[model samples]
Target chain A: MTAGVTARTYMIVGAEPEWWYRDLVSCLQATFGTVLARAGVDPLSVLGAGWRFLHLPGDVRSEEFYYPCPADESGQIDLGSALAPHHQLHSRWWQPADENDVWREVRETLADNRLVIAAVDNFHLPFRPAYGDVHAAHLVVVYGLDETRGVVYVSDAMPPAFRGAVPIEEFLRSWGSANPSDVQDAFFSDSQIGRRCLDVRLDAPPAPLTPELLGSYLRTDVEAFTTATSTRTGLAGFDAFAAELVERCRAGDADALRELYPFGWGMQAQASLHGELLRRCGRQWNDPALAGAGRAVEAVAHAWTGLRFTGAHGLEDPRAAAADIAHHATVLRGKYARAVDAVGTTAARL
Target chain B: MTGIAMSSVKAGLCDPVDISGHRNNTAISAATETKAGAFNVWGNSFAAEYLPAGGSLVHVDGVPFEFPPVCDGPDNIRAAGQFIGVTPGRYDWIHVLAASERRCEDTIELSFADGSVDAEPLRISDFWAAPAWFGEVKAFESLVMHYPHHVQRGVPAMMWAQRVPVTRRAELTGILMPRNVALHVFAVTLQRHGQLA
Candidate 1:
């Protein structure tokens, strides 16, 4: 019997069915990384460093040709000229053909380790009008096939909707219909497609710390901030903490200075606070003082109070605060570096 | 253009000779005229002004009150101050105020110019106290009156002609005189029932 891999088990875990394409992508990348590692497969080697799904055009082409211009290819095929022959291909995935055949082709494409991306034309589903167009669909891995259900369980680059598990029938319909004049219905003949499949064992989803994903994890914090509970003071306490740090820096406190360094609390706070300050200050951040102050507060708040306190401060998400800190830290660090460089240059000249 | 100086003084009031008699004060009684609509007490009493001698009606404040050349007769001049009589029904009197100079402070008193005791001398103080008087009465109410002007320019100036509700007719006891300075006052009395003899 195969050892139970956590990543593989998580692949079957039910998720919000109606996740967006981007959300699914992020989840796949995250899950696949851990899963592949646990499966004894080097994720880096299989997935490649900085591996990303390339977007495909949602149009019909004159001919089928592998993308990234395969080294052995006879130059680039002009889409307008190739449209006729490409349409004549007997691939089941190409519509005006059988749906089951299309599914088989898609499955084969996934198994090939080639990235299969479908540009959904008029991507909105009939049941869910809000999903709008599935501009891009990237299949990262095929987990398994539900023979009884006739459904393919696949990891996608797109975020899963709240009602996860996109129906194979529905996905095919969208994928087949997205035929633009310049490109094919979906990316089938790409060199990268079916090139390398990673034998990754997926892991349990990580607790999302970023603001966008914070909603899934920190419901209470979001509610507290939205309702404006006095308990959740938002960056006010963080501001105070930052001020103390600044004071310590002014006073030449080695410990405080060390805390402010770009490593642990200081770096985290700076990144988180910078994001928060950028949002709050918006265009007002043209002034250095206002922007700096916003960043300082963001950093201090996140460092002293794990984003859980964001709820206490009437803030729905700590991720926003974290983002602010990060942005502010970056800006301040750049300025500080410049200042230091100027001072060093002057000293060297003297 | 030639400078035509207009001046007028009551028989009992001080008068300088050789002054052009362009200044004329006319009054219209409200007793016979029917009130056409609801007591629009706040409407402008002085709808238009006209100087028969043709020069702009230069207000004492240096602001010019544009009076079109439409007033061809004395009746139109009398109708200029006809707004005071605008009660819900026919009124026994219509107190009309006229400014003779441009700065707003030169007092104009209408009296029996011929020294005929038949015409009563209307006191300026009496006109100032009546509810039907023009302009704001309460010192503090004036501040409220200014609020609308602060909201927009020219609004308060237009609101200056609104009517006040008062029971008594104001009476002036002196001769009518138009000083070189502008004067804003209400002229009040019982309207004449028939044609004056």
Candidate 2:
């Protein structure tokens, strides 16, 4: 560590965070993936360890990085745990301690050799495709803060991927943007940026995944899907969610359609990753049933396209879209049932 | 060009199917007025300059295709349970130029000239800066994506060359596309089995 109390710059010693990304993932998983990589864990195995359906009614946020993470019994929200249920990952949202100096927490985190995931408005970030055109909430990795040079090093793995220095002023504006709604993008707008940042901590390194370990996780997930719980969970939970979605669409509730895009993303990304992981393990073990099960899970991911885009296109005149909306929802439900059955059977053997 | 050259020499190869009657969606747009094209929900579309001219002949992997008209009118079919009748013939594979709202794999039912029917897999990758996850060829790419209001750089829009197998030996008659709105088909060609064995 640098000796001087107020060093001009602070950066992690060896290398920048690995850019872990997939086409289906949101900024939420992309940022967490980078953090998990820096902690010496394979981001895919940890992030894709579990898959289940979760939609908290009236809890959806209009942000690109929105993920459905329900608060715990004690009312604590851990996005890290939500993303990586099988790993010892935890995350909390925080803002600058002092309104006068917003960089205080960021510099401290950098000094501690931890990368910060800051929420920024794409309209103000010059590297973002939406810069100066659309106000969408997004996430980026902040590796270093050079107060002396007036630059903030940032990394984003989304398309037109960028990794370089951003002027501190530009960064600040993006981080503090109101993210007002624009006609161009109705899905990811009208959310306040509020300079929120995630403080992620990998309390313990993940253990190497084994067949038995993965099997247990799969079993737990299957049981969760099969068992009826007080909260929205399992196939029953999905039924309730789907029913309400169709009913709301017929009633012309725009918010229901709006929430589906971002909320559905988390579920879709989880299924894709988990399915990919299971397929990899099945190939290594030469288990055809397991491989088929993985493919089934991937089908669940692909089915999300039908439902999500239907909601997206059907945003206006949702009443007109009700039939097709119900159609995709039913199709997606069938996919979930098939996938869960296949995964359950395979897990029993593994 | 090598692909196009190979297309001219191949024997009993896939004859490009003329399905102009099926074109119902416009996925390509001019930069001057980007709002005309609505390929996906975000009002993004492929750039016309980066693609073949309207009504041009193009080939990918030695397979011939009639490239759709660009920005002129309906250039693609946003699959919504559309059924297209094909020239009745025995075929080995069904090739298509397609892009999805996102990565998608759906089914397309093939009705044989006889009584047999089979559901073939139709997979298309995302046009919005995504790799072909289902082992498809990168057919065409617009280096810049067109948004509703402005041109977006760095995010390239892609069109893929994807194919589905015609395992049945009977002559093919028609294709019943899935009700998937996410899958967009620009052009299709039927490769006859006569070229093989």
Candidate 3:
């Protein structure tokens, strides 16, 4: 061991990631939003411009950041492409190349002036509410590292928004946590952190959004919803998914409810952002019908709350919760139908 | 906080209602025993330190309200379709101290003496370190969130003052809460539309 050698310190060159937050989004969107904002792009325009209903059955993970990333044409999973189907958002998960010296990749990333989005366990992070208690899988941003001071500069846009340094030992533990099963948080626990980090890149700047441009996106999404596919997608796909969910609940399958929370979050957040963007555009463009359609879509987002929470609270006895689950699912289906109809009409005019 | 108060509270415009009987959820916890609270599925709660004395007459923007108990049992009403009978009178607004598991928008039925029922939108923002998305008044904020096992700093738990419009001119009978499991009501005050209201 080189005891007398100075410890290396690396940090992104004068970059303070902005906090891009919404009540409905998880850490995945928030971290990506921050990175996108820092790259001089509006997060909503990229992440919320287009929306589709895709429920990859048996693919939902027990993590707050779980979003269905369908296999690409080349057989590789690219989450960024899935999240922003209309934009050039590229992301891929990676780990430390050198197992013995894990900070090497981070230093190189920092040297290249890039922020790292790292998966972490909430139990070891001092800022998390679950610190020293539950072990839920979460994500945070790492912008700097100082080996000499033994601290890593991190930022988390989640509740109690934090932007400060954490001890290297504590940060490493959280980053590399096994994230074992915890009864406290059924949806976000049981996923290993594995010191995983996401390398995000915005390949190109988004085109200026206009009524005609947004109308095209809306038409595309509406077509996606209406058309049938081999994968779980669109209105027909949603009906099948909801029917199976209700059937599973009636059969007392707890796994169905367990999967609902994380899966529903992605859909809810997408609707929320898309609706917000539409509303903002409608007002700016003085289009009353578009604004009303935006509100309808937001209602769809709000409707997810009822279904998701009902499924969450009913985890103990799925059979007993079937009626309520079925009721909420029916209500949500109605909302999606109405919202799609409204957005479809509005898009046609635009 | 100041901006939140502007949208939520109407000074000298509200009459505090008797809502203690409707309290069914305990959302505030003492530092010593944080496990007593079960506000959400995860058992997170607001800290008692940053709140008012239990059952005190507190005012947000001059609107008086009967603050619920602190570290006491059942400080808020976890909405479950409970019908709250109100004094028969005409009111313009129904101010409520509330929060939600997430951002929620639902309807609360207002019953009138004419056998009429009107459902008004009841929108509340998330209490978990969130901004006022629904333009609610920030009534009280617990600087630190209380978990079942520990008191967590930096994650502030918020209480909001939101309102529902009572458009009917007829005599109000009772209010029917929504069947949503995510919404919680801490206190309610009816604002009389008249000069003495």
The clash numbers for all candidates, in the given order, read 84, 0, 0
Q: Write out the backbone clash pairs for model 3.
A: none
Q: Which stretches of candidate 1 lie above 4 Å from their native place? A: A1-100, A105-142, A157-164, A179-350, B1-197
Better of 1 and 2 by lDDT: 2
lDDT of 3 by residue, A269-344 (tens): 9999999988989999999899888888888888888889888988999998888788778878888999899899
Ranking by DockQ: 2, 3, 1
DockQ of each: 0.01, 0.73, 0.65
lDDT by residue (tens digit), candidate 2, B1-197? 46545566542487888878988888999999898998988788898889999989897877779999888899999988889999999888899999999888888999997878899889888889998988999999999999887888889999999999999989999999988889999999888876432
Candidates, ranked, TM-score: 2, 3, 1
Task: Give me the runs in candidate 3 sitting further than 4 Å from their true place.
Answer: A1-7, B1-15, B193-197
Tens-digit lDDT track of model 2 for A1-350: 52222477877657877888998898888999998888888888898898887878989999998888888898878999888888889999999989998999988888888889999999999988788888999999999888888899898988778888999999999999999987777888999999999999999987788889999999999999999888678888989999999999999998889999989988899999999888988898888888888889988899899999988888988998899889888988999999999999999978
**Model 2 C-alpha lDDT versus the unseen true structure:** 0.88
Worst 10 residues of 1 chain A by lDDT: A83-92
Model 2 clash pairs?
A: none
